[model samples]
Structures are given as structure tokens and as C-alpha cells.
Target chain A: MDKSTKCALCPQKAVVHLKYFNRKLCKQHFSELTQDRIRKNISKNELVDKNNRVAVAVSGGKDSTTLLYSLANFAEKFPIELVGITIDEGIEGYRSESLKVVEKNYKKLGIEYKILRYENEVGKPMDEIVKKDQRLPCSYCGVFRRDLLNKAALEVDADKIATGHNLDDEVQSILMNYIRGDFSRLARTGTKTAADTGFVQRIKPLSVVPEKEIALYAMLNNFEVYWGECPYSHEAFRSEIRDTLNRWEERSPGTKYQIYNGAENLKELLKGAIGGAILFECEICGTPSPSVICKSCEMKKEVR
Target chain B: MDKSTKCALCPQKAVVHLKYFNRKLCKQHFSELTQDRIRKNISKNELVDKNNRVAVAVSGGKDSTTLLYSLANFAEKFPIELVGITIDEGIEGYRSESLKVVEKNYKKLGIEYKILRYENEVGKPMDEIVKKDQRLPCSYCGVFRRDLLNKAALEVDADKIATGHNLDDEVQSILMNYIRGDFSRLARTGTKTAADTGFVQRIKPLSVVPEKEIALYAMLNNFEVYWGECPYSHEAFRSEIRDTLNRWEERSPGTKYQIYNGAENLKELLKGAIGGAILFECEICGTPSPSVICKSCEMKKEVR
Candidate 1:
């Protein structure tokens, strides 16, 4: 271990060695740097405005837990209100334990919180839905989760919906869209916020931070972090891409950040090339969707 | 061996099984399909036009060998002239043998041929340049090769330069540029031709066909295919991406085509996003370039 190397700023023994930036940081400095990076991402993207009510999607995982904690800290400087929203996807052994972490953190932070369930909104739990249609549990879960997050944000009268999508997730998504030949999705990957009114503008504050660093920050801060995998989370394609990217990242230390930056530059360069999102009210649920009926409504019908 | 499955197009025993399309084709039909696909790509992208002279870049590999044959056949129907240009990069064992194959094919096809040497143009061969700067042999080789191709094409007065960049090469480049965050290169990947005057437009006739299919097609056509790898061809990152994509393609058929189609869609969608290329006369060489000095001229100075 290179523990003898002093921190970049102080004389403390460094705990974390960042290969990308070639900086050795101690525990205190590392945590401070992580938070500072998130603050910079938020400000650079204009994710939060003064007097804005933001709904943060907290899954009690390391990423969201870290994001919520960082945002709360940020609230001390900016005039912004944050509300915590957690979705109980009805996974028995998985979600219940993670929800406890969210509850504990929200209560301690003195933030208003809301817990929504799939059974309450979608008329069926994921456990039951997977039994009927065993093809795409992830597809069903994603559609419903996104729908609920938008609805929950609107219910709170929030101006923005924040998610714990760190750099790894964002870059993986960019690669996934490119591999799947989904050009529209590829074009829309790294935009700071959506421009539609019916949909709450989604902001990813941790988009610049790597997942490992977020986990480290969460551990350093003593937040309750759930390391459980979702029981219904099986995207084989995504897993393959993640493994490939992780291998590449291992080989080249700063690959994830390069991909993230490349994505942002591409998005900026092609802003006009990718046309505006033409959203319409879903006929059945009145949600905003490109098609006549939203994906959530279509999946709900199948589940029922 | 699945010898029991009959050919989908003919009564003869099937020699090739295309997993992507789930079709078994005999030798005769497979060759026909390969050529037809190339023809479709050419017509769809408007790669060739009437009364246009095309400089076909042939390296005596399976792809270029197959492309030359296809273009010779295509010229019979379309009122276009074909000329073959080979770049002898001065690789001792490699270029000398490949040039023989090009000579044989062009003579048999009745197409005019031209060969240029790097030592003559750049004042030094790649073999010697790699000794001095051992880091990026591929980069130096690429810059010189591209510059030579453009100059040779101009000498032949060809309206467009046709390259044998099959689906695998094109998709690999798309993923590479995306990974490296090279949006400009990504946006320019599959374009049939450039709009600049001094720069000859490039057309990739074999962009839709897979590499394996091209090799098979070359074998069926009895073309003298050079199976040697370039001595200086060591792109570790590209090799990794190629392996990953091949594994994905093996597990999921048609992944390459999807990636190719997706790249095309992305290029079209991001046309306005990636601004127009600004071309200025190079200070050292009067070539159209974005910078004051062209890449070839800069590289030539170093190589010399």
C-alpha cells in the first residue's frame, strides 16, 4: 500500500489513490473531494435552482444514499427543498431491507419521505407479474419505476426529479444504447434534464462520480448501504456490457470518465440533430409518452 | 456438421449457414447473396454514379479482393469506370506478396492499376519509422496510408475512392470513436463521400456485409486472398473491442448489422449536431485540412 504518501492538500496519510487524476487523498480529503465533485456537477448542469423543490429517488443503495446525503449538504448553501421517494417494487427479501435503510437515513436527515408500491399503483407486484410473463422482468420493472417516479415527483409538486445515476451507470447506458442500435436513446443519454412539462425534469447529480467512489463515500460517511442485488434484475446484455466496460476500465484507469465526457460532448454537438421529444398524454393513464399510450399503461394491461 | 439442412435458395448441399439470418445457403447462392448485398449498399448510399471514375483501394486482403471483383461486375451494368490503387507500405514480406495478388486480379478484370510507395512520398518507410518511435506504428501508418490513397485517387482522376471496409470494420470504428469520445469521427464513419473539393469522396461498398461473409465470398470466387497480418498492426484496444463484439455477435446473431444500422441512423440524426468540417489549405502541403498543416505533412516531417 502507498499509505506513506501524504494527502495532496495536507500531511495526513492517504487512504485512497485516484489513478485517473494521480492524486492520493486521505479519508477526510477523499470524502470532501467526492462531495465537491457532486456539487460541481450539480452547478455545471444547473440541475437545481433556487426555490426549487427536488424529488430524489432513493433506493438505499450506496449511490442513492450518497447522493441524498450530498444533496442535503448542498441544501445548506442553496435555497432548495429535497423530498425522498422510495419505490417498494414488491421484492420480498430485497426491497424491505433496503427501505429500512432509506427510512433511517431520511428520518435522521429531517427530510420528508414517501414510499410507493407497485401493488398500489400497477395493480400487481413484480413477483406475481414475473410468474405470468417470464420474458422481461427488467423491462416491466423499469417502465413501472420510471412511471411511478414521475407521478410521485408531480404529486410532491417538485420542479425536478433526481436519481442516483452515477458515471458507471450513465456510461453503461450510453454503451447499451449504442450496442442495441437505439440511436434515439443514444442521442438522449447524457442530457442534464428533459425539456417536457408533463414529465418532471430528471437530473443525475452523481453522473460524474464513479460507482466505486460513491460506495466508498457512503462507507466513509457511515450511511446504511444495501449491497443486495435486485431479485428481478437480470439483464444479460447489460451484464455483458458492464463486464466489458469494467475490464476496459481496469486496463485504462480513466475510461469511464472518458466515455462520460465523450457522451456529454456528443450530446452537445448533436443537440439540434436529435429532434425534440414529442410527448402526448397517454389515453389510459394521462402520462406523457411519445406514443398514444404510455409504456407503463401497456405493461399494466399485460400484468392485469 | 449440419449437412442435413438443405440450401434455402438452391437444391445443392448447403456450404454456409448464416446464423444471423437463420438461412443455409449453398456455395452458388451464398456468393450471389454476398454480391447482391454489396450492390444494395452501393445503390442505397449512392456510392457509384454514371460516368464517374472510382479508385478502388485494394490491399490484396479478402475484403478488398472481394470488393474489386464486385465493382468489376457492377461496372458492367452501371456506366462507371474502375481503377485499382495499391499502397506499398514497404513491409518486406507483406506488401511484395499482396501486390502480386492485386496485379493478378486487376489484369484478369481488365482494370487499370497504380501502386505508390511510402518511402518515395514520406522519405522513410514504416519499417524504419517504427524503429525510431516504437509507440504508435499504427498511427503513423494510418496517416501516411490515408494521405497516399487520396493523392493516388487524385492522380487517377477518380470521382470517389471506394474502400473495402466491411460491416465489422465499420462497426468497430463506430464503437471505437464512441469509446474514445471522437464524435467528429463517429459522425463521419459511414458517409458515402465528403463534400469538399480537394478531398476525394470515399464510398464503402462493402459496409453492409460481414467480414466472415466476405472471406467466404473470396474463397468461393477463388480470389488470391492474402492471409497475412501487418507486422505493425497492433491496436490493443481495437482487438479487445473486436473480441467483445464478436462474442456478443456469437451469442446474439445480427448484432453487427444492428450496430451498423444504428451508426448510420446516428450519423443521420447527428448530421446537424456535428458541424460542417472546415477545410483550409495546409501550409506545408496544399491539402484540404482543418489545421494550418495537414496530418500527413506533420507526420512526414517527424518520419523524415
Candidate 2:
């Protein structure tokens, strides 16, 4: 982001410097590059194709907001139906505030959208759940929110559920599972998301895009986005990994990409063993799970 | 080590506290437990058994000396034939001094041993190779020594080549390759070593024991071991992993064991794809390699 540096693609002043590829870009070229990357990722992974309705999960955060805009443009350019799905976990000072940003974006973009709240969907909002459950808020909130999003997307008849999980998120998850030695939860097959049973095949169009670039994209475009951490969000394990990975990336750029590539290679190798892993229906909620009870249903049982 | 703490197994004063198992033991019981772990690991992994000739690669270091003793005691109890093999890399003052301690231990224990110097086996010793080669001494030294050990073990008609790789070494190697994303070399099958193409299978009897315990065992047993570091030894990546793993182990005990366990599970999953990987004989030295030329033969070519 040098003031005097020229864009790698043009003579305009470089506003964003991508350390991984050693590329500098101006506003226009940077937007184009970011959009092109997302478009290519979508097409390459077959995340969105002609006449397919994609439910883009937005959290009103920078990543999700940027993904909404990116996907909107992609929908216009290509022949795909687009819808926005936002889950309000009902955390105090967080969900209500961010919901406004998401609503504004949905209205402005003229996209069909649904906002599911934990209060209505799961009977207990995150604020209430946190006060009751001694466990970490994220432990159940994440599982609950993910389930709500998937169910909502499926209700809308969407063929795919695309999340705003950036490259940093993917790399952190890969390394996190690796460090914890949780091989079953590590990398597996089918592009980014391959679903069976009642699970909708999820996709990440912005998987290749780093989080910083998404923030920059949101800022450069002046998108109405709520850029704040959730009050109930305290994922200790993930935060540690995020800090370590960022420091490693600072010293060694493209380390994230290498990790992702390695995980993909590992997925192919693990494909056979994990590919046949069957999903069972939760006896309580009828959600596809590896056990008799889905995590969300278990959370619901605890809440009740 | 508590001043007045009683041994977990006996009334004697505790000398070593095993954090992983939360056990404290006296000098005698600690030795018994350490030996028990090694013996159990050997039997469980089937590293050594009755009537099989095993070559113990003794480098005169604490781990090797402890491993040598442990294996000898194991051999005596289990009816196995044991022979010591020492590789003299000729690292100036380092090797000559350590070789003396190894010879002393061999005579005291009445064990059959062979001291193979790099000068006689390969064209050049490590000291000379370090001077000529611009790469790290370990790059060539590791491959060359491994080849030499395999050949000597085969020459001695041994069933397996047992090395002094303790838990720390095993965990460090697992993390190093993992961090590097070198999955091909990460983890495979056959307990610790699965060999083909005239390659002697390798085994690590002390893979379950920590390095600190090895040092303590040597001290308690009063084994004649050369206590020093190799002047030519400086593994940057491994050192980094070692330091980080130590810090993690301090904060969260048994992190090392978890990593090792996770790797074993991963190995089982990866066994099918990697199990059939065929090793070919090097055209030059007729050693087993994935390529036409083995690493040792390639090094020989470079040396010549």
C-alpha cells in the first residue's frame, strides 16, 4: 500500500499490496482482480452454475458483506440465482447492530434474503444460552448457527450454501485440526463442500481470497458492513492458531496457500477412508449427523 | 522431583515425575518404569522379538547409550540376539571421543560391536564433506549415515535396525515434515519402519519415551555415555519445532503424545495409498530407493 507505488496492472497509485503474490493494485484493478478470483473460484469449484440458486451466508461482517457484493455481481454476470441468508445469534450489542447492515445490503442489492434468529429457531438466543451454559458460548452457538443457516438455505430450495470462509479461516482450521491431531475433522474430499443425506453441499467462493483482501475490497467499495467482533465470540483455540499463522505469514508469505494446497493433497489421500463415512439422522431433529443426535439437537436438549 | 514425595509405586523418595501419566517414582522404580515402557513399546510395536538379530545404532549419545542398555536387557530377557553398530562420521574431536565411550560400553557389556567410519565405507568422512559441500552437513550426513547403517545391519544379518529415536525426536520429525507440508515423508505404516527392496526394516524401541527421561536413565544407571552436542549439528527447522513443542509441552503436558497419536491415526488412513509404493534399487549402489539413484549414491557422485 505504498503511496507512490504504481499498480502492477496499471499506472494508478497502488492502494493494496498483496504480499503473497508480491502484487500491488489500484482501486479499479484490485476490485477486478478480487472479483476475478472469486468468479474463478466459484466456477473452478462448480460452486455456482447456470440456473442454480445459491444461498450466500452473510454475518454482516466485512467478509460476508464483501461476499454478498461479489456474489451479486457474479449473479448478474453469470446465470445463477442468488439469495442472502443471515443468522442472528442474538448476542447483546452484536447481532441487532449487524443485522441492520445486512438488511441494508439486501435491500440495496434487491436480493431475496432470510434472517433467522436463535430465539425463534432454537428457542434460546446466544445471550441467554451463555448465561445458562457454563461451556464456551462458541461451542454450541457455532453448531446451532451453522445448523440454522443450512436449514434456512435448504428451505429456500437453494442448491448450494456458500459461506464467506476466507483463506485465513480455511488455513486456521486445517492447522488447528492438525495441531489438535483431530484427523477425522481434518481435510477431506469434494472440492470445498460435498454433502450427503439431508446436508446441502456447501461452497466457499471466496476460499482463495485472504481476509485482509476482503476487508480491503469492502473498504474500497465503501460497502455498508458491520466490522466488529461478536461479544460472545471467544474461540481461544482458533485465536491462538490465527495469531501464530499470521506471524508465520508475515515472515513467510504464501504459507497460507501452501497449507491449503497441502490440505487439498491430503484430502485426496484421505478421500477413500473418509469418503465412505456415512451420515446418520439425528433421532431428535432428523438432521444428518454421524451420531444418533446432532450437535444442535443436543444443544436444544440442554437448553430445554 | 520432590524432596519428600513418596514414589507412586513404592515408599522410596520420588526422583522423577512423569507428567503425562501423573506418576512419581524412585530411582529404582523410575528405571523399572522406563525399562517397562521401552520393553512394552518393543513388544507392542513388535520392534524386537525372540531369536531375531537386531542391530542397535549407538552414537555414544545419552539416548543411544540408554537404548543400547535397554535393548541388551530386553534381549537377555526375551532371547533375542543384539549387536551394536556405531557410525563414525569422523567429526574431528566429536566422533573420536564418543567412539571411546561406545567401545568402553561394548567391552563392559560383552556385546559384539562394529565401528564403521565414513572414511572407509564412503569416500569422504563428514568433516571433509562439510568443508567441500556448501549445503548443511546434515543434508548429506543424514542420508549417507542412514544408508551406511542399513548396509551394516544387513551385513551383520540383523532383522531390524534399531535407532535411539525417543519421543521428542519422533514428535519433532512428525511436526517438521507436517509444518513443511511434506506429506509424502510425513507418516507411513509398519509400526515405525516398513522396508522393501533389500532394505532392512528400521525400529525405534524408545519412540514412546521422552528424551529427558533417557538422559535421567543414563545418569541413574551410570552408563558410560558421551555427554555433548555435535559441533557440526545445527538443524534449524527441527530446533524451531523442538523449542516450540517444549513450550507447548510445558504449558500442556502430553501434547507430544497427542501429536504422535494423531500421526499414527493419520498413517492408518494413508496406509492404503502409500502402502504399495515400490522402492527400486539404485543403479549405481544397488540400494533401495524410489528413484533409479539412491540418496547415498547420489551423494557419492557429488563427493567424487
Candidate 3:
């Protein structure tokens, strides 16, 4: 409630107050703390090794943009090469604006970038795909985006692909899998990186950071970021879960952290029970999939 | 929405419409369906065995009353014996009325009944327990009730102890344990019956049935059930989860069942990963416990 409180670590005026940890910080200290937390997460999870080429999936949103900036900052200390990859889902007004923001950040940072389009890969843009059969846009978008990310990462010869999945996104995903009774997805929710044949290991450096904190970090650091909802983001069930978690976090501070941390612990205990995802080649596309054909190829065929 | 629709299985006018399954059923068919579901659950899970004496934990609430009546009907076919066990937490205006209902049902069914009081076992009532500590009444109540139930069942020489936990309660518990980051509790949630040294195996016949259906079944069966809530039923967090699940169920029917069924499936898949509850004699009471002393004994010592 007090906007002009002093920073906990220094004498400078506080710029951000974290309710979960019950701390207020000045601009300089807040940025440092944000980077430090991501650094610790990377080291704790062994997310990167010496001379590792990392591909970051940037969507121009606060989470991805913050992740890219933080990881680039982290690169100054660690021996890692960073590359930016963006998927244009072909949502008219949304994708174009976000792409501009992504391009600005990558250009300013002097990082190499690649843009993948849904139309090029799947033969249909999301806008057209939804027009044909609009039952679950997320399902189609998720499968396609994931397939393209992996493909682009492999093409770029990257060892690991990084995503801007923050604590809120991670917890929402964990709760969603639990609610949907999808055990395989639930089991893999806690891992920092996942590996399969022909699929680069995926890393989430910002998985521990809260979304609000990421947005605040972007604002404090003056990162060019676009904070717009995707036009095709109509996940009603996910929205319900997000609202439930937000309410819980409001009532009990650090609930999001607890859910994420608890999931990690459970995953460890159940590791033997929930083995790693089974890898098989998709008959149609030769992509890594549990079944004969990957989800993307199946959807692509259906959409066509 | 149509109140006068005919039963899906029969030509009789519908008495209840199940939104989840999207079917209307006559009173006779609804009752049959309810009982048949429980019967199949018991058989599928092997909740009861022939010639086994089972102790039903009755709190005089609709769930317990309905459970007792249903189990009584079930016993007519199976060769198992039934007895009722009630714990009087000493909540004034609440326990007394519920005890009358328990007594009435036990008398009508000719089932043996036993009453255990907190004052007798723990040397104080729930009211006094809360008056002293005044935090987490549910925690204290749960520990005390579970301990008393196990002790009473053992004393009555019953092989299994049955509780009135419905679908809502089961799913709430699964989600709550998950949110709390309690992996140990989450691992033990889906077992139909938990076995421990000197502890009776516990069974939940109504675990698959929803709360609303349980209430309706009690009404149709004309069981003089007490619908009063416990005076100490102020679980704020649980209430939040209940409301969240209720809203989701309203928006998408079968959400509760999906959570429960999914948990069961996951538990089966993770059985090897999550082994049975660790068993050891409690240092204070010689009861089965994973630690030096059991949770109930630990709480009793603190309460005293």
C-alpha cells in the first residue's frame, strides 16, 4: 500500500514490492534480484553448459521479452550463445505488432533471429484454420507452435530451446494437466528441460519468476515489450484455472510458488512411477511423438 | 431444464436430471443407478469381502446416512456384517441432532452402533481445542476423527472402516494436497483402502457419487438424516477450492468426476513410484506412523 517505501537492501526509493516474498526493492536492486534469481534457477537446474547454443522462443510478450533480456544479461557471465525464434501464428493484428517488438529487442541486443510462420509450415494460417473448424484453437495452436519451435531449433543447430514460461504459466499448466487428468503432461510439468529424439532439450529460465514480476522488470528495465492478448487466446478452461490460482494467490501470498515448488517435489517422488515421455517417430512427419503420427501432422491432415 | 422428461432407460416420468451425463431418470431408475454404481465401485475396488465385518463412520450427515442405508441394502446380497461408528466432537446443537439420526438409522436397520467422544479419548472437546489454539480447526478435527475411527474399528473387530467421502470431498482433497505441495499426502489419496499395522483398512463406498446425488438419494430413501453442518466447519481454504470446483462443474459438467477418476488412473500408473504409506509403531501410542510418533498423538500432546 505504501508506494514510497525504501528498498530492503539499499537506501534508494523502492520501485517494486513483491508480496510473495514480502520485500520492496529499488529499481537497480529489483533488476539485479530478477537476474540473480534466473541465474540461480539456471545453475540449480543445470539448464546450460559451457559453449551451449540456446534458442529462445520470443513472442514479444512480457514473459518472453523479459526472458530474452535476462538470459542475454546472463550470457555476459556464462559462456552461452543466444538466438531468438518467433512463431507467427498468423493472427492478423496481433502477430505483426508483437513481431516488431521482438525484432527491436533482438536487433538492439545483436542476437541472431529467425521467424517461422504457420502458413509456411502447416499450409494454413491460424485465422484460416479456425474458420474451418473452431472447436479448440488452443489445441491446434499448441501442437503447431510446438512442432515448429522444435523444428526451428533443430534447424538452427541449437542444443536447447528456451521458452519464456514464467511461474504463473508453469503453475497454470500444472493445474490444467491435473484437472484434465493428463498424467504424462503432469509428470513432465516440473522439469526444467525435456529431451526427445530430433527434439532439442527445452529450458525455461524464467519458470520461477512470477508474471507480474516479469512485467514489472520489463517496465523498470525499459525493455520494448508488447502487452497484448492474442486474438486466438480463448482458452476458457485455462482462464478458469488462472482465475482460481490468482484468487488463491491473493488470499494466500506465494500460492503460485507453492504450487510450482510442490509439483517439482512430487515429480521427484513419482519419477519412477511416471517415466519419461515415450519417443516414437511420427509416421507422417517423422517428428517425435508418442503415437504413430504426431499431433501436428494429425491436425494438419484434418485441417486440410 | 425439462423437468417432465421421460427416463432414458424407461418410460416413467423423470424425477431427476443428471447434467453431467445429460440424462433424465425416473425415481426408481435413479435410485437403481445410484445403488448400482456404488455396488460396482465396491466390487471393482474390492472394498468389501465376504464375511468381513465393516465399521461405517457415521456423522449423522446426509452423506453418512445415505452411506449406511446403501451399505445396508448392499449387505442383503453380500455376506458381510455392518456396524455404525460415530465420533461426537462435542459441538453443541450439531452433534446431538446428528447422533439421533445415526441412532434412528442404526435402530431401523438393526445394525450395531458405537459412539466415541473427544472428551473420552482426548480429554477435551473440539470447542475447547479451538478455544485454546484458535487456528486450523479442521486440522485438529481431522487428526482426532481419523485416530478415533481407526481405534473404534479395531475395537469392534471390524476388518474395514468405511467413511462417507463423496466425489467432491475426494477431488477437493487431491487438489488441496497438490496446492499445499504435500507429495506424501497426494500419493496416498487414491487408495480405496489404506492398510497399516494395527489399523483397520478404510473404505469409501460413496467416493464416486457426487454430494448432490447423495443428498437426493437420502431424501428419496426417506432416511431421517440431519443436514446441519458442523459448528467448526470453517475451512476457508477448502471452501475456496470447493467453490472453484463447483463453478467449473457448473460450466463444464463432469469436472469433479474427471479429477477423481484421473487421480485414480494416475495413482495406478504411479503406484511403483509412490509406494504404500510407511508403517512404524508410534513412540507415544504404538499406532502405525511414518515418523517416531503418529500425527494424532502429536496433535493430542499439543492440544493437552
- For candidate 1, write residues A164-203 as lDDT tens digits: 9988899899888877777567655563655554688989
- Better structure of 1 and 2 per lDDT: 1
Tens digits of per-residue lDDT for model 2, B107-205? 888999887889988888888888888888888889989998988897898998889999999988887666667777875522467655367888888
* Tens-digit per-residue lDDT, A133-219, candidate 2: 899888898888889988999889899888888998988888767777876677542246655546877888888888998998999
lDDT of 3 at A257: 92
- What's the TM for model 1? 0.95
Q: Which stretches of candidate 1 lie above 4 Å from their native place?
A: A1-6, A187-191, B1-4
Task: Kindly give the stretch of ten consecutive residues in candidate 3 chain A with the minimal lDDT sum.
Answer: A189-198
> lDDT tens digits, residues B1-304, model 3?
6555899899998888899999999889999999998999899999988999999999888889888988999999999999889999988788877888789889999999889999989889987898999668889998899999988897898999989999899999989987898756666655365554357888889998999989988898888989888877778888999999999999999999988887787667755665666678999888888888999988998898
Compose the digit string of candidate 1's lDDT tens values, residues B1-304. 3446689877898888999888899999998888898899889888888999999999999999988989999999999999999998988898888888889989999899888999898888777888888558998898889999999999999999999998889889888888899978876657475555468899999988888889888888788889888988889988988998899899899998888888787777776666667888999879889899999999888878
Compare the candidates by TM-score and give the number of the best one: 1
Q: What is model 2's native contact fraction?
A: 0.43
**RMSD to the hidden true structure, all candidates:** 2.1, 2.7, 2.3
Give the higher-DockQ candidate: 1 or 3. 1
Report how closely model 1 matches the true complex, as a DockQ value. 0.75
